[model samples]
Target: MNADIKNKIIKYSKEIGIDKIGFASADPFVTMKERLRVQQENGFQSGFEKGTLEERTKPDLLLPQAKTVISIALAYPSKMKNAPRSVKGDRRGIFCRASWGEDYHHVLRRKLNLLEEFITNMYPEERCRSMVDTGELSDRAAAERAGIGWSGKNCAVITPEFGSYVYLGEMITTLSMEEDTPIEDQCGTCNKCVDACPTGALVQGGQLDATKCIAFLTQTKTMLPERYRKKLGNRLYGCDTCQTVCPENKGIDEHRHPEMEPDPEIVKPSLEPLLTISNKEFKNKYGKISGSWRGKKPIQRNALIALAVFKEETSLPSIIKVMNEDPRPVMRGTAVWALKEIAPTAETKHLLQSFKTKEEAPEVLEEVEKALADLSSQGGMYV
Candidate 1:
């Protein structure tokens, strides 16, 4: 690799809004393939609908002529207070802090595309393709190889400068360049991430069981299983319990990157307001939110689920509306599950009883009776 060429590209990359950039020789990552094989064998990414062995192993999927991968990481701005300590309107709510702002995918994609254009301009004979977690490229492996960061046990890429809050972007190229040294894995004996998980999804050895994973349960387009509800705590979207406890995520203000601006609505949308919104309205309020793309049902579903976890019975009116109004029986089922978790009051008891006589959806009715059963066990107390 020419030193002058590498220096010029690196300089241009940083100038194009990427905090850090590095190169890795483009070859089928045999080790990553092997790990992926094991993960598939052991069912690591099993919950993912489109994620498959062939889906992950296709080398040409990332770059048709991939000779080298030019990877960059952008630090997401974050604060400890961003994670919710309570379900009150003041608390931001318990979800991943990274999802709080503008979609990192959009922010990082523009930067990667600019860098790709700049690189292509310099090397007219070569080609570059911008990839932002859209292909088979092993990003964590790429991040590790590029010295951008090492993957934490929670599977988040952690940088010394930005901890684990960096969003990764890649520019696959045919240009051969000098690669950076991979960083050493720093997480040793500390298991704060595992200990802090509300669900025991982090079973062991960097394996994540999506069935028990709160983030997975919330974001997945399918139905959430019954057992994971209370374990979800007040998390309405993705869960960030593991990252918050990691030791490496120290120093919130000093080395923090200043470019990221999280959208205010995602920072903290009110629980009461969520029930009244339709999908069209949801698109208007949350279309830009990372959580919004999944559609209003999941967000509304999780909001009711969270209200139940908080046991804030005062949210019952709105919760009851969502329980009855949501067209998706799956969401309504989860809403009833949330109501049960919140501790049923007399009005809620009557509502549950009323749903029993008139509820048509079998899934919704299954849980409606379960809610009454739950209330009976809890001594009919209003939480």
Candidate 2:
């Protein structure tokens, strides 16, 4: 019966499309506590610091009776016809594959539920609960402890078969299963992920400052500080620079999941679409998407910043017009900055005259004033 339960889980998990599953005793991962302590001191986690997160990383906190953890990984296909992740003449934009789909939270949690049900049917005496990255538990650490994969310096787990593009989840339960030994670190002398980061946020070993992390900034609601905007390139939602440069990811057989394909508009999206996405269309296009979870204003602002970096003079007219209409000052401020950098045409000069008089935020006004000065220097009227 014990062997049958184990085999049933492996068999069923494969059938459900997961790449790997492993079990580990739910003993407190002593190493994880130290890692979490160090990471907390770094203060880089930012918005990820809140939620049921604190308790979930600690096995005992989630389920006092928990005696086992089952770790699961699902691979996001690496094949991109657009060649965006590569750095050749193509210069692929980096996007970590994990987030490319329907939130793995729904995808893996449903699987975890089925696995739990399968376990309980075998032993009705046990209790079980499952979670994806949502659980307070350190899903990465559990994956390492369960021998699912080694934790790479990029802070992603990499198995030989899936490379580093796998998503992780956990099932904490009262029933103990035979545990697997953790994989050895294979990222020997590899600094590609660290060096590839446009921001110096990955300055130290496995630690990262998510505040400076482009992935976090793309999704954040507040205006991004100027220091990091230069590094974001065109990414509006997430960044995958480190993962793309990982040597381990090379020669990977691309795995495709139709569950999360890039909506062409969002992928390499034009500044025009961002500046004009209405609230209704924003909800319809991004309601289930992680990028639009914070709404369109932040993303639109990011798009404007991206345009500024590219010096895209063509988008000037539409962006300059919206600088006055966007309700969020941050969005307006971003438009002001982008237009000043990229547009500053005769029409823009006319609008900034009105903008200069009515704008209220001090920082935004400062940016507006600077943009006006820059435009004036180029012989565009700024009065």
Candidate 3:
């Protein structure tokens, strides 16, 4: 009966646009718990994770009498169709492919809810709990155990059909079912992802130092550390370098879900305008995407860094406006750094020096002083 029901659930999943589905016993993720402990002890966690280790690893804790875990994967497009170019005067910043299109949280949750309803109708006495990425259970671990994909060295779930370009979600159900065999590790001696990581965030195969990961760093609300500034490149929300360099993900561009399609202008937006985007405008533009979950400040902050990285002289006026008029200390401080990098001219030095007088925020003032010191060290009259 469980087998028949399992087959029916799989069929229904495909009908509802679930790209991949698999089932596994709802056993505790013992190995993941140990790895998580080490990650926490080493301060490698990104502080975005939810729940205690036990709650994260034990399915029964989340839903009593859980017997089977059903994992689902939805493929997203990797290559942007009609992608706009980022030319010199019009430099652009990027949100990672994961943030493309509508927020996967909403998309995946909707699918999960549909699956839950189907299961309850089939077995009215049985109970089920569903969760996406935000849930305590490690989606990748559940997916891996359920044979949705093997855990890649880049810390992504690599599916046979979708490569690593898939979003995962799962449902823990009380009904027992035969479990699918887990996929064998296919990444033999493939270190491309680790070797290509800009911040050395990969740490080692299947492990990541989330603190240094640009993907995690871009989502942070605080001022990005100076060491990781240049490493950010033009990525405003997340980093895709690790996945992009992986041989498995090479040439894998799935357009299975229309909702996951990216609008070129939105994902790779011009940098300068972001610096002064009103909150309402930011929301109206990026509110649907997952990247905007942390709000517009981080995206705007990264835009300043991207402009500085390009040394975009055209954006100097905009950056200066932010330095002088922006209320946020992080924005003002970041603008000061952008000014120094973009154009450390006599005018810029004078502006910083004068701004120092009225800049009451210690952090912003510190950035102003630092910019002035950097200009002085260049051995110029700007000092």
Candidate 4:
């Protein structure tokens, strides 16, 4: 009876657009508990993780009669079709591929709801709980246990069919089902993702130091540490270096779901315009994507850093304009950094000197002082 129901569930999942689905015993994640302890002790957490260690590792704690976990993966497009050009004067910043479409939380939740409905219909007495990324259960851990994929060294669940470009979600159900075995790690001798990481976030094989991770760093609202500014490159939201450099993800571009499609202009938007985007405009343009959950401040700040990385002399006037007028200290301070990097002129020094007198925020004032110190090192290059 369980076998028949499981098979039907799998068929229905595919029919409802779930790219991949697998089942596992709803046993406590004993091994994962140790890993979480280590991650917490080392202060490697990104502070965005949900729930306590017990809640995350124990299945029955969430759903009293849980017998099996149904893990699902939906593949998203890896490459943007006809992506807009990032030219000299009109440079654009990018949101990572994971954030290209509608927020995965919404996409995966809707799919899970459909699966839960199907299960309840088959067995009217059946009870199920569904969760996406923000849920108490670790989506990757559940996916790994359910045989949907193996946990990669880069800390992503990599499926043979979709590489690491899939969004994961899961449902805990009272119905007992035949469980699938976990897959073997195929990463073997490849260390490309570790070596390619701009911030050395990958501590070792299958471990990540989230604090140093560019993806985590990008979401921070305050002044980005000076060291990571250059490492941020053109990324406005999350980092994809680890996935991009992984051997498994090579040539993988899945565009099966239309809702997962990206708008080139919105994902890789013009840098200058982002600096001045109003709250309403930011909402209208980016609210649908997961990257915008942190709001416009982080994205705008990242845009200023990107302009600095490009040394876009053409954008200096715009940078100066924001530095002088923007109310947000983080934005104003970042603009100062960008201004200094783009060949600070005598006029620029005068502007900074004048601004320093009126700048009250210690954070913004510190940035002004640093820019002036850097300008002084140029030895009349700006004078």
Model 3, 24-115: lDDT tens digits are: 99999998899899999999999999999999999999999999999999999999988888999999999999999999999999999999
Q: After superposition, which runs of candidate 1 have C-alpha atoms over 4 Å from their true positions?
A: 46-61, 80-95, 253-259, 343-347, 378-383
Which lDDT tens digits does candidate 4 get at residues 163-265? Answer: 9999999999999999999999898999999999999999998888999999999999999999999999999999999999998999999998998899999
User: By summed lDDT, which 10 consecutive residues of candidate 2 come out lowest?
Assistant: 86-95
User: Whole-model Cα lDDT per candidate?
Assistant: 0.71, 0.74, 0.92, 0.93
Model 3 scores worst on lDDT over the 10 consecutive residues at 374-383
lDDT (Cα, tens digit) per residue for candidate 1, span 1-383? 57788898888876766788877777666666787777667775645434455545454565676677778988776663444344454323444566656666787888887887887887889888766765556677777877888777887888888788778877778787877788988888778888787878787646677667777778765566777767766576787778777888876432244435654445566666776677688777666657665677666667676666667677766666767777778877877877766655776787788777877998888888777877777772542
**Candidate 1 clashes between residue pairs 3 or more apart in a chain or in different chains:** 101-262
Clashes of each: 1, 7, 0, 0
Model 3: residues with Cα > 4 Å off, grouped in runs: none
Error of 3 at 56 (Å): 0.4
TM-score, structure 1 vs. true: 0.89
Pick out the ten consecutive residues of candidate 1 with the lowest summed lDDT: 83-92
Ordered from best to worst lDDT, the candidate numbers read 4, 3, 2, 1
- The estimated TM-scores of all candidates read 0.89, 0.89, 0.98, 0.98
| C-alpha-based local distance difference test score of model 1 | 0.71
